[model samples]
Target: MKLVQKWTVFMLGLLVVSFGIVLTIRAELGVAPWDVFHIGLSNQFSFTVGRAGQVTGFVIILLSFVVGKIKPTLGTIANILLIGFMIDLLMLVVSSPTNLIIRYFYLILGTVIFGFGAGLYISAHCGTGPRDSLMMALDKNLSYDISIIRGGIEVGALSIGYILGGPVGIGTILIALGIGPIVGLSLNKVNQLKNKLQPKIDCYN
Candidate 1:
């Protein structure tokens, strides 16, 4: 059933996001590169992560509409809501870091959870999120190894976060090193499950 499939995707997406948040909470030092940049930009302009994320999502969605012919979809709206809501909620549960170590752990857990959600939520292929759009664009433009390009983009984002007052601590480091593989593994697993459980679905690309 379409409803059942969407439900499964929603639940899995929640788990993935929760896991990433855990990492973010644990990586006490700071955020990974991209988040750091986004958070940093938010701070420089006196905005919350949720607001920034939504704004960014809107901008990227518009761009996608122009370039890739991506029409508005429920999943796209969900992406904006999901990130914005969680970032706001986290401001309550994840406190300002007292030390570098605390931030390190928070970020690590958050990254894992985030990656997990990316794999699960993205399987729906309803639409790509803001951050993902940037990556896909870079992947096409650079015409080189995707992982390397991604790493470069992350570093740039982290630098921006540093300037914006985001935590550029141990958490950032852990994410730079670990989060990619976790996402890849999760995507692979999700794909396998999809193939076995429902072969007719054409969600994943």
Candidate 2:
């Protein structure tokens, strides 16, 4: 039952994250750095954004394993497969808001939702997502602060994405600045909740 519950929460978190990604795209305001890279691939390669993400994620997972010796977990595999599919499915129905204000609203809301979703899944302790795994791998090998590694990766992604003609705007800036703090806060809160519940969950066993 605990295993079932954990996976349920993990899947739910991915679903929410996918919806958040689609919302950001629909806003047309720009997207997170890695997402910018995915969108760039979609534009250049004639793939859907979600398909592009899946391909990119697969490559990253491979690299993480090969170079970083990071084994893929079940959660990581699910993340690679499911988030992209969910994003594609949601994008079909979620329309762009024409109003500038509403677009900004979508941008912010999407970022927050994405953060919380990330927090929920991460706190489940199943595994880190592909990109995050890659970051951890890099941190292990390079011995750089995780923040520096993450920032470097995002900057690199953003640069390539911009060159590939992905959308770049204020929303990109907002996501870069806001997502960390939001995810941090959400993760802290979710972990706290989980800690509180764990004893009761264990009592059942």
Candidate 3:
């Protein structure tokens, strides 16, 4: 894998991630926990979800710097801008289905897609997005399992988002409980596939 390949994977992963996020919004059952926070900010501040996400990304990036003493990578910067824009763009064209069965389908599909996208970005190894960076930093500093740290982050975000009037439903709880394991599973599968396809060089390159 070359630098260009890494970048392409990173960008594609973000696009896929954003599309999945939009799908969840369209599902209308609820959203992922961090997204619940973003929606809350959007509602309270009179901004779009993308705008709120970008602002939150900036804040999280700064926190990552403070905690990890690392500068944002090009991948990180791209993740912040690209996912935000993609979500807004997708929202313009997509809408929620009225049927209950269809809505639940979208929710499950979106969560799975989001998990796979996250795995792809992590496999790219260019860098992590701001929120993920913060989570990783905390995991390192606190010597906790990634799963535990992720759950804690979700709980914190959910609590704050709820307080700030973010929408919550069964889907939120589903995402909160399932995302970590899904992401880990996806990561393993992706790495295995990458290794089988290109055994000579590091997939991250």
Candidate 4:
């Protein structure tokens, strides 16, 4: 029963995060750096963005497993598959707002929701998603501060995606700088709530 609840929460988080991703893309201000790379691949290779994302995910997973020695968990597998599906499905259904102000609203809303979703799954403590696992693995193996490694990854992705003609805008910069703090805040809040809800142990005489 506990396992079921955890899985449910994880899947729900994935769905919410994927929706937020689609919303960000629809806003057209910019996209997450990794997503920019996916979009660039789609534009260059004539594949759908979702397909490109799946391919990229597989490669990253492979690298993380083979080179980084990170093992996969069910949550990791689900993340790779479900997030792509949700993003594609959401894209089909959700259209971009025409008004610039409305679009910025979407961007902000998407970023917040994305952070919340991350907090949900992470608080579950089942497992790390592929990208996240990879990030941690890289940090561990390379002996660099996680922040520095993350920054390097984002910069590399952004540069390659830009070179490949992915859309770049203010939102891209905003997400790069802001998402860490946002997600960290969400995680702290969620963890605190979880601790509060947990049954306290009583010591017997």
The TM-score leader among the candidates is 2
How many pairs in model 4 have backbone atoms within 3 A of each other, for residues 3 or more apart or on separate chains, i.e. clashes? 0
Candidate 3 lDDT: 0.86
> How well does each candidate superpose onto the true structure, as a TM-score?
0.74, 0.93, 0.89, 0.90
Stretches > 4 Å off in candidate 3: 136-149, 199-203
Write down the lDDT of every candidate, Cα atoms only. Answer: 0.69, 0.87, 0.86, 0.82
What value does the lDDT take at residue 35 in candidate 1? 70
Query: What is candidate 2's lDDT per residue for 1-205, written digit by digit as tens?
Result: 8788888778888998898888888899999998999999898997998899999999998999888899999888899899999998998999999999999899989999988888877767777889898998898899788999988988999999999989988889998898889889988997777778777772111
Summarize candidate 3's per-residue lDDT along 1-205 as a digit string, tens digits. 4887888888888888998898888998989888999999998997899988999999988987888775788888888989999999999998989999999999999998898888888888887778788887787688788988877987898889888888799899788777788899988997888888686655566
lDDT of 4 by residue, 94-183 (tens): 999999999999999888888788877777776777777778779768978898887788789889998998888998987777777888
Q: At residue 169, what lDDT does model 1 achieve?
A: 67
Give all candidate RMSDs, comma-separated: 3.9, 2.0, 2.4, 3.7
**Model 4 misplacement above 4 A:** 140-143, 200-205
Query: What's the CA error at residue 132 for candidate 2, in Å?
Result: 1.8
Give the per-residue lDDT digits (tens) of candidate 1, residues 112-149: 77888877876766666665666666565567787787
Query: Which pairs clash (backbone N, Cα, C closer than 3 Å) in model 3?
Result: none
Per-prediction tally of clashes: 31, 0, 0, 0
Sorted on lDDT, highest at the top, how do the candidates line up?
2, 3, 4, 1
